[model samples]
Target chain A: MNMSRIVRSTANILFPFILVFGFYIIVHGHLTPGGGFQGGAVAATGFVLLLVAFSPDIIRDKFSFNSMKYTEALGLLLFIITAFVAIALGTTFFFNWLANGGIIFGESVAFGANPGILNSAGTIPLMNVAVGIEVIGAMGLIIMYMLSGIEGGNKE
Target chain B: MKSKEILTAIIIAVLAASLLLPSALMVFGSPQNDGMDSYMIDNGQDIAAVNNIVTGVVFDFRGFDTLGEALVLFTAVLGVTLMFRRMKEDEEYEYE
Candidate 1:
């Protein structure tokens, strides 16, 4: 269906909740079954909903091409750097030193959690976060570019 | 929506099973080694350092495929840019 004003208004009201719930799934992924890709797809859904419901220009100012470019590049760099750090530690690539070492980070870490628990997936958690950021950023940027009506090779 | 009927049916069936399998396992299977988890714990470290068995399996043990996926995404973006360049230009000029 074409973008409806009623749908746009409803989405505007619901977008924040969708975004928060998506973040929850991604962050708690290690403890449960969900992870970066699933959560990233969920998060991207919020944006997609906005784009589909409202005209692209309405959300254009909030999500710009430059911002998406920066976030996507940063996400890729972060993933690569994480892998390289494993190499630096003298382990095979993406060897996941953090899990072997037993570290709990980011929000929602349960106190006194032990290694080998479903909740303690080590570097995988961080990797998930990085992937989530990268996926959302890349997709959001691409969508923005398409919706913004920018021509190929145009400086603007 | 009509075109999506078959895909939607498949998706619903899969999701229903994913939801049901875990609960069924909880009733009949042990907490550990529900087939996949044991295999993961066993080979996860040796196959890759990542403690998360699934990650190791997807990103390291099976890394060749992920590389292909990234390349595919890049190519899709390039193709879209080529196809829509003229349309984008027309929209911009109309706005001005």
Candidate 2:
């Protein structure tokens, strides 16, 4: 079911901003209060807004269930692979091998309080991004499934 | 019926009291074990290289737990999809 023009317009206008903010939260999770899960939830809310404003058919056409499934699998795979890379590097699983390694996201942090650095959190940011993608896909798929179920029920 | 209502009320009150008594008696800011908390706070930045201790703990020190949590969400979604698919199949079969 489509919403009023005003609601649809507002949703269209606000969706990009919401998604940007969610990505901000996910990317800066190592330095901020929000993390992958929280950011993904926020991004999913944007999708939800669009879903509510437009009809299920429109949303379904835009975001297929198969695509969301792949997105979630890709995110989970990335997360697992990141964790396993530590083992390949001769360290224990989930070890912060990148931290202080002077490579990507490997800038060593001082012992005491200082300004937060974006490129110093090792695999935390990577994991955050992975989880964020997974959450977005999962949440979107769940909402879409429920909406489809409702639509099917209405058809009967 | 009146006695059952009274019993239910009493049970609820007892449960509420049991739940609240410890919280009321306990301190708010201080934890029973500060060892892990202090260690994380002290060395989390050096180890995980993140300003947020919570994130460090979640993604670094306790990474396995986060993995488990992610798997839980994935499983829940999988279950929902499976249930809906079954329902859709049944509906289509009925029509045929």
Candidate 3:
């Protein structure tokens, strides 16, 4: 069942802002206090808000269970693949190979404090994105599954 | 019943003492070993090229731990999915 019109409208308005904030946290994780897991949780909370405001059938139609499952796997796969790429480049596992490589995300940082750079931080940002995606998927799935269980219980 | 109450009180006292003793003895906001902490603070920015030293340490210097943590989350999601799937199947079976 759906919530009151006021609640539904509020959730609708706030959802996009929440998602944008979450993405900002994920992308700027290298420069900010929040990172992948925290940002993903924030984003998943937005989805939870929607689940609470709307009917389960509406959420199920919009966000497929299979897609969420695939997203979780893909995120983990991307993370591991990035690590393995380090090995392929003749470095130890999880090495910061791209830190000073002068390539993508490879601008060398000066020794001490300065304004944070978004294009720097090398594989750290990449890993952060990967983990963020994984976390968003995993957290969304857990809540969705529990909601399903609750619906099933209601039916019986 | 009195003996049981005494035993519970003793257990709670011991647990509280164990938790409080460490905080009472150690200095707040100062680590026992600053060697690694100092090194990371000094060089983590240059090495990882990130302003956030905590992110550098988590994703670069000690990335394996992060990977393990991700694995743990994936496993938990998997377990939840499996449990719920079984419950659904059981419900269907019952209907039949």
Candidate 4:
């Protein structure tokens, strides 16, 4: 059954706001309460809202299974590459080599609490973004497949 | 029969409490408290440059675990997709 116009309108209104909040959680993960998994789940809630607003087929067109699969792969690859890059720079795996190095995201943090800069946290923020994308893609694929299964079951 | 059921419920309640109470009562991050957590808390900012020590722990200190978790999620998604694969449109619902 198609959702009513009111529901669709509400979903549309809430979608962008939710996305912004989720992204904020992801990008500020190293300094905030929420992190990649939490933010990704929050973002997926918006997608779920859209799915509920429209029929599965309509929403599926916007977020196809193949696209989601590729997104998951890309996100994981980013995570792996970020982890290994430290080793390429002559450090151990998952090492915080960029800290205090005066490069991108290389600012050494002060000893205690203070105003946090966005450009801080070497590699952690990158990992957060990577994990965020991976979780979002993985969760979206799950919802898509479940919807497909329901449609399949309903058709016959 | 009512008395028997009452006794069974009491027994189960006691058993469950015995099984879970020690864990629930114990302070989290205690005993091994001197290790890891204190180190992370004291040095996490300088080392990882992340204010959030939890994030530092998850992404930097214990990254392999995070990767393993990702792998687990990926495997679960793969399993789900495989289970529901190839169910064509207009195909009849097969019954056992």
Candidate 5:
């Protein structure tokens, strides 16, 4: 077994586990010390590892910068829209009016968790998840591009 | 960057202060808001509605600015990449 194939196998086996762990950190952020930025960085590590083990062309084909561009913008827009909704409801901008215990899907889950200490912070947890997704995609794309240059590929 | 300059100045100030340690005793700064401490503990949760005080302060009270901070590095990367691409294209055209 050569180095590249071994790397590929290792990355494939580990990527899903890394993503699930990242999601766990993001959802449980309010209760624990990890939040959007930390979880997002962790999530991006999988993409980065894949980029390192594979070729740049594969990285580009798998995750396009254009899609990441939209994902980043959408994340920001979602955050803004969430804040604006609060404003439209007659509260100040970015107010957590709905965070204190709102009913979602006929069940009450604290901001991101159910009946837990992490449940009190309303939209903050949701925002963390959104930001986490955005940051992971953005960082993954950026790192992949940079790695392509180092890997002797000029096509982006 | 003004932020970078300000950070540099703060480091310099701290270093200078270490040289003249006597003034450190007189460097205590007063709080800006008269009742900020009490108000924070009393009405903090209600205003931001976040269980974590830091989260409320960062995302709720200072959200607009946080968006700008997040985009700064993204924009910088995009700018550098564009400039490099433009220069490379210009060089290739000149060669042709």
Candidate 6:
């Protein structure tokens, strides 16, 4: 279903901003109220807005099914490998081996309540990004599938 | 018609059971004692090096749970993709 010009223009205006907001939520998941899944859903909502405004053919041209599938696979793979690497580091499986160890993302945290540093958490942030990517891909693909499968969606 | 009446009755019974069971079983705004609460409050920051307790709990302290959840989502996505595969041979699904 094609939206009016006003709705379409508003969606065009709001699309990138929503994407940026979603990324912000994902990146700051360790320190903020939002996280990977929430951010990914937000991103998917932006895509949905675009889909509602434009045709499925147009949206499909911008984002194909294969790209999203591969992205989901890559995110899951990254998450698994990150966990296994902790095992490789002589820690137990899914261990926070990088925390407070003075490596990358290994900043020691001061005890007690305060605003958190972005670079403090080690594997958590990495995992958050992975999960965020996975969620975005999965939700976007689902929305695309459902929208395209609707009656008369294939016409024109 | 008989089956529809039975289904409607069954639905009402289920709805009543759900509504009544929750009121009888749960106490609002108060939870039972939790051992992990105090432990995480004390040591979560030192372990995860992160400020948010929930994030620490989900991604660090109980990371295996997160892993399981991720796998579940992956499986769901796979199921959706498979279930909605293109019907036409010439469809542009990009399986490759």
Per model, state how many residue pairs clash.
Answer: 0, 0, 0, 0, 2, 0
Better of 1 and 4 by lDDT: 4
Give the alpha carbon lDDT tens digit for every residue of A1-118 in model 2. Answer: 7889999999999999999999999999998899999999999899989877898877766888889899898889899999999999999999988888889999988877778889
TM-score versus the correct structure, for each prediction: 0.64, 0.87, 0.86, 0.86, 0.71, 0.82
Give Cα distance to truth, residue A80, candidate 1, Å.
Answer: 1.0
What candidate 5 gets wrong by more than 4 Å, as runs, is A1-6, A105-115, A151-154, B1-38, B45-49, B80-96
List, residue by residue over A1-156, the lDDT tens digit for candidate 3: 777999999999999999999999999999999899999999888988988888887787788788889999999999999999999999899998889888999888887878877889999999999999999999988888888876532111
Better of 4 and 6 by DockQ: 4
User: Model 6, A17: alpha-carbon shift in Å?
Assistant: 1.0
DockQ score of candidate 3? 0.56
lDDT of 6 by residue, B1-96 (tens): 699999999999999999899678878755577567878988888888988888888888888999999899889888887777676756665576
Error of 4 at A57 (Å): 3.1
After superposing candidate 3 on the true structure, give the runs of residues whose Cα lies further than 4 Å from its correct spot: A152-156, B1-22, B86-96
- Model 6 DockQ reads 0.44
Q: Higher-TM-score candidate among 3 and 6?
A: 3
- Residue pairs clashing in model 6 are none
Error of 2 at B41 (Å): 0.8
* Worst 10 contiguous positions by lDDT, candidate 4 chain B: B29-38
| A-chain TM-score of every model | 0.78, 0.94, 0.94, 0.93, 0.83, 0.93
Comparing 2 and 5 on TM-score, the stronger one: 2
* Ranking, lDDT, top scorer first: 2, 3, 6, 4, 5, 1
Q: Which ranking of candidates, highest DockQ first? A: 3, 4, 2, 6, 5, 1
> How accurately is candidate 2 docked according to DockQ?
0.54
* TM-score of predicted structure 1: 0.64
TM-score of chain A of 2: 0.94
* TM-score (C-alpha) between model 2 and the true structure: 0.87
Model 4's alpha-carbon lDDT is 0.85
Among incorrect, acceptable, medium and high, the docking class of model 4 is: medium
Worst 10 residues of 5 chain A by lDDT: A104-113
What lDDT tens digits, residue by residue, belong to model 3 across residues B1-96?
599999999999999999999889999879888999899999998888989998999999899999999999999998998777744454654544
